[model samples]
Target: MRHRSSASANRLPAPRKRFGQHFLTDTRVLDSIVEALGDLSGTTVVEIGPGRGALTDRLVARAARVVAIEVDRDLVQHLRARYADRPNVEIVEADVLTTTLADLAGGPYVLAGNVPYYITTPIIFHALELPRPERAVYLVQKEVAERMAAPPGDKTYGALSVNLQAVVNVEFLRKVLPGAFNPPPAVDSAVVRITPKAEAAIEPELEERYRSFVLAAFGLRRKQLVRVIRTVASLDAERALDVVTRCGLDPMARPETLTPVEFARLVRALYAAPSSR
Candidate 1:
């Protein structure tokens, strides 16, 4: 029943667990999410995982153009057929993460979706990597949404936080109750607003090194970063201690203790140090 499954006197199949299909069925919550999108106007909006078109209808109405990407082939056909009459809406059958900037069409677009919780990270990474998207809004797992928007020194802050905040400013929009979904997820969901940073806080040249360094530091979170660096690189504790001093970081500081800027400073200092090689 691909591309032909329309709501009939007899409804189509319910949410499928394999697709991680937790369809958002609450109309009030749907309106709230669209409101948070805020003035779609002439802008293009891309909806990821538009299961059963609950949120898709609201989004397509708001934006000048809408592209809905769905991985499930059955859903793609159904969605294509459902919105086939609307020239403004296009249904692309592919994983959202594989989609590139050029594939998204001419200018900056806004991204919105109730994404599958399992692949949220890669999806966020994909959106952040896009050259034209002005922002992204997602209904994600509540705990993860908090971690995505978390600041330095928080327990949730780490590679994901550092990498994302480096490119986008994340804000927790609102929490969504499990009852809002057809097949309620085991955990509650929340919305997050992603606004990309025009200017990076760290030097672009050292971004990868900085991330590797930060990840290495966090690999052994219980130990001081100085100790972890010695384990990750050739630098002995004494020389690693020297690099820490040059970077103005405390010898006893753990990965959780450093800010992104401080971590960048450590990256610069460590690179410049002869012992770091």
Candidate 2:
């Protein structure tokens, strides 16, 4: 019910480099992002880094309720004033990294954002760590998008790819060019949709172990799996190879070559083996 007035009147705040602010001004790309969300008529939408309320306006037009969380104080004031009359929109001044998703929306909701490039992964991880949302859409750096949706053995495959794949079905929606933003970013960006798989369930303890093992393996990515595992899991070469064999993986495989499931299997094997005790 509210609208962004002419910038000449309010004199919009400058995009801060520290906040990684890049205001999306392209109408076509904005429409595509909203369409990608697909029918959010009655769902609460949590938007992170709604710089100058460009994406926020579109979200408000469709979402049942829009909770716009802005970390930058300047933009927060602009959004609050812009949406002051819109009862459906709540402008929350908070850091997305520190704020819990549960605190923002009570029931079923979708998470959307033109996330800061530097903190994109943390934001996605935070959302996924919460009780799963219906879906999450982010306009992140193209490189990050590719990595999040990367398959095993792909050049971009690493810890992010594996950890995200272990829980969500990641889809790279579309490529957004740099010209789309007011002060365009040097690198291009892409929209990504992350949906939690219904059956992708991992217990808390196992999930922790899975994260630890995956991170350690990727930390020594250039090394063979056997040696990396030996160092990370504190196992000798024989024990490391044993875990790899139990997981149906080859001793010569590198960390980046293994799929998320493979990592989980290897972690579980190591945890259950007698030598791990």
Candidate 3:
């Protein structure tokens, strides 16, 4: 079905609850988001969930090409019609989670999105996968942004923090309140910029193991490092203490206090340590 232009008719499709749609309507915030993306002159941007095309309008102006992925059929049709005349903008009708950035962009690209709140973490991790985007700017829930950019020893620091920080430099740009959207979300939102590190703390080959190790550590977060290593590495108490101490981590220190580098160090140590199970 051909969707009418929201702009021409002064009507927009109702925000679908199933898709977790909250159209960002604040023009100031919109300008700030596009500005945060830096120069896109010759860049290809993969925009996730381009609801109502507010950000898309700004992105298309600066970006050489934009592949806007929308899961909602109605929004997809609307976007397709909206950008029909523009050869540079390609509206992809697919779930961002199911489609990889490499597949969509075909090469180096920047990612921008006001993603669904429920799937924000998954989307972030997806973007961080192999053949990663050059840079990514996301409008995510404020607390999730804090968790992403949280430092070691912070209350919000955990598996997500360590996992993302190990590979990328996370910057919490600004906080956005609920009123900025067409239908205000219950919680506040924030913008974050993520740039891949030239030298990641953990090697690509070790990323899966690193993620698993970090998850195990935070699963038993309240416990000491010695205990976490013992359980996750299937080592004896003495061996676990040896490995923890060898990593220069205090045997008594909790997982939440360890930095991404420390965690990567511990992962290497544990991988090298023979199991005593």
TM-scores, all models, native as reference = 0.88, 0.92, 0.94
**Clash total of candidate 1:** 1
Q: 1-277 in candidate 2: lDDT tens per residue?
A: 3475445326588999999889999999888888878899998998888888888889998989999899888888888778776899998889988888866887778888999988888888888865777888899999999999999889999899988888889999999999999789999999999898776634445776787778888999999989988999899888888878877988998998887877877877776445432
Per-model lDDT: 0.78, 0.85, 0.90
How displaced is residue 112 in candidate 3, in Å?
0.2
Candidate with maximal lDDT = 3
Instruction: Supply candidate 1's per-residue lDDT for 89.
Output: 87
Comparing 2 and 3 on TM-score, the stronger one: 3
Ranking by TM-score: 3, 2, 1
Per-residue C-alpha lDDT of model 1 across residues 43-114, encoded as one tens digit per residue? 888888888787888877778998888888777767777877688888888888788744665677888899
RMSD of each candidate relative to the true structure: 3.8, 2.7, 3.4
Clashing pairs in 2: none
Number of clashing pairs, model 3?
0
Q: Which regions in candidate 2 have their CA more than 4 angstroms from the true location?
A: 1-9, 272-277
Residue lDDT tens for model 3, 170-261: 99999999999989999999999999999998878788889989998999999988888889999999999888878888999999999999
lDDT of 2: 0.85
